[model samples]
Target chain A: MKAPVAVNGYGTIGKRVAEAIRQMPDLELKGIVKYTPDYSVLVAYRQGIPIYVPKGKEGVFEEVGVKPSGTVDELFGSVSLVVDASPGGKGAQNKRVYVERGLSALFEGGESPDVAEVSFSTLCNYRQALGKKYIRVVSCNTTALLRLICLLDRHIGVRKARAVIVRRASDPKEDKGIVNTVKLDPPSIPSHHAIDVKTVLPDLDIETVALIVPTTLMHVHVVHIQTKRSTSIDEVVETLSSTPRIVVLEGAKIGIDSTSKIVEFARDLGRKRYDIYENVVWRDMIKVNGDELTIVQAVHQEAIVIPENIDAIRAALRLAESAEETMRVTDKVLNVGLQR
Target chain B: MKAPVAVNGYGTIGKRVAEAIRQMPDLELKGIVKYTPDYSVLVAYRQGIPIYVPKGKEGVFEEVGVKPSGTVDELFGSVSLVVDASPGGKGAQNKRVYVERGLSALFEGGESPDVAEVSFSTLCNYRQALGKKYIRVVSCNTTALLRLICLLDRHIGVRKARAVIVRRASDPKEDKGIVNTVKLDPPSIPSHHAIDVKTVLPDLDIETVALIVPTTLMHVHVVHIQTKRSTSIDEVVETLSSTPRIVVLEGAKIGIDSTSKIVEFARDLGRKRYDIYENVVWRDMIKVNGDELTIVQAVHQEAIVIPENIDAIRAALRLAESAEETMRVTDKVLNVGLQR
Candidate 1:
């Protein structure tokens, strides 16, 4: 029997999670929850996925001419797992509802680790989340970082890591009043990212500073990692290329020169909303100087976490015996890494 | 009296060099040399800058309905310095003409070090090029690399360096039939960029790989430098921030996020062809992990060499006694780091 899962909050992350859950063979998307009768609510309805509204906001859905199938409270009893894709702080508020119903839950990166039994990254702590009542699937940025770090750590042992996140201001669908000027994160030294990554790999030394730029395309990351052993650029490339979900982009092989072109390639391939589920690393940009490895990669902020969400479902419920088995199934079913 | 300077070739590099020379108070735009009466030749004519053609191509200009002021031979006798902005190998051919005329000439990075008396970068070797007969202003990529390297070497010694060049396939005007796939420079290992940078900083150990991406906007570089001494990300940022021609972009302050938005910002600023002449370093992307310093910066391929061309003119003609004075004048006239 497929494990039933409900996606709460139909924003960028919520909508993607719902679609991914529906695609997985081991999971059933019970319904999607939305606070307002936005266009996504209509999309969820048209996709034949049931939609639920917050307890107090049910009346507003009819005013917007769309009928939600039920209230969010009704979703708790029907699903074994509740994936909270709500806005940053809202996950904490919604966690109470899930806990009271004794349902396993997954929260997005926006929430604190305290909100869940454990913070999760499929590559770093997939096994840890198994049989856990609550798991927080790390944010898109953390997921992208973890993929590289886990690969490097496994192959050559990462001694230290640093990253600069050129973040997108907002998702294409929503407007949060993106600023025009590039400003440093306030109290800038060791931005919250460093702390977040630690939750997965507690001993790893990583420092990150994030800047929100005015483009809705994707977040570009410039990463520098120092390896424990000597390695060459070619060796580093070979290692990363072999890793799953890490798409190595060569300008000649893929005919894509920039992140914008990568988006175009995805759209041309008829990907869902041009979503690139993999971490697009510039194949040419992977270099090793002495023991340091450097790479420039683009992370599609909205889509990267989608696959992780799917894996987190199986992980939270102990459905998959191993991460490799879960990742292989997810990639095969979702067509993840086939773009290249 | 202004020193007369002639720019040979009417491609991306040549046009910018001609315009920059025209704007400088210390130099006079003698004439621009074009092998073909392309649209850019017409542009030079419309801008009231005198246009010259290769001896045999003079008639081609009139056939294309654009009048040439004289042959390239006439430019040799009229100018004190000739900046060879021609195609890669063409500069070697033009070098013989400059020698025959006893005219001091500056070659673009396309030419080998053997073609010139010294390889010049305003930040690295302006003094070395002073009063020299022939000098090659390093390529846009080399110039950008030198800017970071020189600063790092000065603040904290650099033990070694590695770089991945995410290069643009073509300039905005030309269509070089850019391929979609990311390709390593054929015979891939260490691209010529590794050697090219050594021309400016011979003692610095560095290795690089270049891939041509299908974007005319700019080239993004992922650089990792192992500092001789340990450093912090804040110290690295402060050092780079103080360097001239290095624009540190913070996502919050400038609202400029991606390379495309940067192009848009340049266009909104009413820049020449929306060109970003400086090396735009993402402030948040600079990180020092252990002993390794990492940065991601964008180089406007066509425009980066423009300022170096101006400085080369000064260096070749002995117009400025110090690089600081020449750079100050060039920045004042061209508005180098004011994009933000």
Candidate 2:
């Protein structure tokens, strides 16, 4: 029998995670919790997915002309795990209810490290989340960083890494952000994203600084890593190209020069929702000088972490004995790295 | 007697270098070469500075109502050394004339490293240029990176250094640049900057990437350096604060945040031409975690290297026996670090 999973929130990540769960053969989408009876809740209801509401909000759903499937408690009691994809800082408050009912839960990056048993990035620490009661999949930026850093560590051995994160001001659907200025995200050095990466890869020495630009499509990381031993550029290129969820685009050959062009490339690829689930690395930006490597890659902020959220559920439930097994199953279902 | 010096191009860097030479007690500005009979030629001519023209372009000077002081060959014969501030790539072609006349020349960062005997950064290797026939001062961005890296290396002993150069799309007076895009300057990795830094400091390991934002004021560098041993934040801050041609500004206390604000601060200080000759470092961006030091500094593209050009002349002429003496003399005459 497939293990039933309930997504506690049907917002940005929760909706994507629910759709991913329904496609997996080993998992089934039990229900989704919605606090507001807005257009999104109506859309999910019209799609034939079960919608659970709070105990006192049944009248609100009825007023929207959509009958609720059940209460949030009923959804929690029926599923094997709950993926809490609520807004940042809200998951920490909702954790008390999940623990009171003896339920295993996975939180998003917004929660503190204390709220979960393990801070999870599938490529970096998948086994650590196996059988854990609470696991937190890191933020979108951290997931993008780990996928490259961990892959390099496994092949060429990374001794030190530094990143300059050129961040997108906001998601595509958001209306608020800087209009014409390049603002420092925190107005400080070594922003919080660096520390979050260390929560999973404790032995890695890395430092990062972030700047929020006016663009909203994706975030670009200018990364420099020192290898443990001397490695050639061809070796690094081969390893990343042969990997599962990375798409290498040669700027000189294909004319993919900017982050905006990468988004248009995704749209041309006919991806569902124009979403790119892979890290888009420019082949022209990869340089290997002796033991040091420098490269530039762009991460689709809205969709890069969706696949990791799926793998987190399998790792937390012990559905697969190893990380590679879970990744193979998840990558195949998501059609990750196949469109390229 | 003041040593005679001639400026080989009266453009952006040449005019500033000529003015700096005029203010020096031990150096005299003999004349400046003007290729175009533009409005700037009239300004320099009215200032009582001699204007020299190429062999055949004497008519161009006559068309602009400015009488030629002499020919380019005459300027080369009169000066003890010629500061070759010609346009980039033009300096390489003009080097043969200086070599033929047996005149020592100082080239700007635009020329190749082979164009000079040493790639120069005043703070890193002032002595390396002493008594040299040809010296090339590194580019503006490379000069900015060398200042902080060499400073930190002195007090904390830097083991590895990495930089992300956020470049201005163009100088303030130029009309050619990106309109509303953040472009990778070369659309490649490890931009020529890292190798340029190594040309001055041969033993230091460093990597750099550059991005061109749609701003014309100044270029900012996000730098990370790993010290040879563990150090505290106080030591790194104190080291940078006590150095010449470097300014430390607090973001919270003074509300000095972005690079644009730094220019405003310099304007408010009533600086001539609103030029900030020092590297404006944000205090809030200085962080030391264990052995790593991270900093964000803004280098005014037009003015930061003017002070270096003065020190380069002193070093190349053997006017000062040590780097510290040259810096002290140059910094005092330019009122560097005085506004703060």
Candidate 3:
């Protein structure tokens, strides 16, 4: 059985994911990728991991002399499964790039994660990625949607879902320049912009519209969902409250709550390491109306990626006996955060 | 026959609407309402039309100051109907305030024009306003939605509808002030949002979300509709293009044209007096995928409101053979810019 996985792109999410991967017994730190000199990359390098530097912004590591195998025979010739944990939207395309290089591993699909995705929050649909092709890990907001939607999907038959994404203009760290303007992107609605729900159900219909609002850190999604059959919002609340990975928040009864406080709560909650049976869920930003519900949810991107990636390597490469076995391993990793 | 209908809140749209309403044969000018005096008000006043103003905002009129009754009723009571020319969304709460005062006649729900209202936009279930208890005008975006949806309901049978609103932020001259984010409004989804549309269809299942962006003149709505019956998007476009009172422009193969350019074109097309009958139907915005179609549309808030107000007045007071006849009379009393 494979004991270690190499992670490329040691950016914001990559470092933590690298640590979490190292923690898995079925996994080892084969190597780490850093485009240039970064603090954590230097640490990992000193700790005896080979640090690969691929030159240029559009530098696909395969092009450089220190490459990731030229063909499928080459990838299988050296490494195990590759978890390319880079950044947002463009990264999905990057995953496609690696797959083109015979890295036919899957992450999570916003519409349907086809391959082995280490989906966080109850590991919803982790089984679907088993022994599959390419797996696409979703965006942070997409992860929040998976956690919330799976809860609703099982308790109530969720027929259709639509979400509006109000994203940050500048990153909390990326002080590239100064500008402020509310912009709407993909300008078109994405049919699968909803979730990494591929594992649980294929051929699902979830449409999403994303907008980039001027903010930073947490990305807020104003989500409204329609159920197949009508159910009271009271039932909706019960369904949400019962879900461990999801935090069902009640929004301010008067004015709209600021994005500032919502993200803070999610960051604090992520620290909890309770088992799936006893996780805390706060319903502060959840707005419900009959079978139709609207939610304002925020997720700290850094914390979500690591656990998901670890589980991905476990499930995709068949290191775990089954998805349940992978979960037990993921639960133990999550335990590290809870104890702190 | 009803005496002249005085136009209230004569600004960008109100000015043109007042001119249109004044041309009716059965309607005559009673007085005019102004917040801050401008060239338009002075011209209407010079023509012997008494202009009423709110107490403090009224220093411009030199004479015995006719205080604005502090409430809408002070003005609404004397007029046959009040055509609120305030900016879009600006009048929602205000409309609610006056509807609470109760109508002397129907506003539009096919209730009592003598007590309720009968707005323009022949497509809306204005007929329902005939015998209703209260009548309220919907937002301009909703107006465009109703217009486009009616075409779908007739040709394809609407199963579901979704609308995304991109709005202008500041009203440097016309629409002013930060009104705060949309808060605690039930039917947060437009199908359920207010205006009592159920008073008509009773089965209109619509979901709408609003976004505040940076713009001033026009609002754009991206609409996706799923039909019960399968009809090609070409058929849908053909139907929309054929629909009267719609401006369907032809250009571009990629996506619908931008919002600003759409409205400017409409303003130009709207210049033909007969455009009230032959509207520039928005054809460029339509896209078909299997049974689902998506469209990008822009509607001038100015055009939707003042005309509706004028029509509501004509029916509410039972002053004319029809609001159309009244509009013919009102057109002679005022003149504003119209696009060709």
Assess each prediction's global lDDT (C-alpha) against the native: 0.81, 0.85, 0.53
Tens-digit lDDT track for model 2 on B243-329?
Answer: 777888777587776676777888998987788888888888888888877888888888888988888888888998777898888
Q: If the candidates were sorted by their lDDT against the true structure, best first, what order would they fall in?
A: 2, 1, 3
lDDT of 1 by residue, B154-273 (tens): 888899887767666677677573543333353244688889899889888887766555466777776778899899978888888775688888844666655777888889989978
For B161-185, candidate 3 gives per-residue lDDT tens digits of 7666655454335546233222222
- Which one wins on TM-score? 2
TM-score of chain B of each: 0.95, 0.97, 0.67
For each candidate, give the interface RMSD after superposing the true interface residues on Cα.
7.9, 2.3, 5.9
Pairs in clash, predicted candidate 2: none
Q: Candidate 1, which CAPRI tier?
A: incorrect
Fraction of the true interface contacts (Cα pairs closer than 8 Å across chains) found in each model: 0.00, 0.37, 0.00
Arranged by TM-score, best first: 2, 1, 3
Which structure is stronger by lDDT: 2 or 3? 2
